[model samples]
Target: MNRWVKALRAPFFTASAVPVFLGTAVAYNHTGRISVPDLILTLIGVIALHAGTNLANDYFDHLSGNDDLNPHPTPFSGGSRVIQDGLISPKGVLIYSLSWFTLGCLIGLYLNWRRPGNVILYLGLIGVFSGFFYT
Candidate 1:
């Protein structure tokens, strides 16, 4: 579990989570109500996206020798050294990343079905595209 957390860069999930919380707060403030289910789903979707992005970054960085060339990798600076450190295989990382992306997209689709717009679909597409190519 510890290795998995390190591979997922779980500490950095706040970068994804804070915005979701703020969005929920804003919606509640405006409507005077909150749907707990939506909140939970949104959180899971965003975090999964975040985790997928992080893993994809690590995989691509390893592929391009970016992480390999880094001489001074810190917890915040360089990509997680899971591959380099042998905590997780590069193929495994890529698979996990894709799995997370799929899960996020599924949740996004569900949320879109609940709502009455294609906004979630558009956003999810943009996120997945950017994340996959962000290396």
Candidate 2:
């Protein structure tokens, strides 16, 4: 449980959430309305994307020996130490990352269907592609 939580990088969920809450607040201010379902879905999708990206990066960094070779690493700057600390394997991280990414895409598809703007789909595609290609 602890390992999973660490792998999720719960602290960094804020990175995924702040923009969402900000946008929600702005929309509520401007339109005087809020769609609770959309807000909840958006938060889940964003957080999943962040978690997947982090896990993928950790897997790739471990594969490339970058994490192992880092002489000095800060908690915030270095990759999560889940793999380094033997909490999980690189393969497990990659699998879990892909799972989260898939889950996020599925959620995005649902949101796009519900909203009917295709904006969510496009953004999700862009984010997933960029994250996957990022080293």
Model 2 spans > 4 angstroms off: none
* Model 2 score (lDDT): 0.87
**Which lDDT tens digits does candidate 1 get at residues 7-114?**
888989999999999998999999999999899999999999999999999999999999999999998767989899999999999999999999999999999999
Worst ten in a row by lDDT for model 1: 1-10
**Where does model 1 exceed 4 Å of error?**
none
Best by lDDT: 1
Give residue 122's lDDT in candidate 1 (0 to 100). 93
Clash count, candidate 2? 0
List CA RMSD, all candidates: 1.0, 1.4
- TM-scores for all candidates? 0.96, 0.92
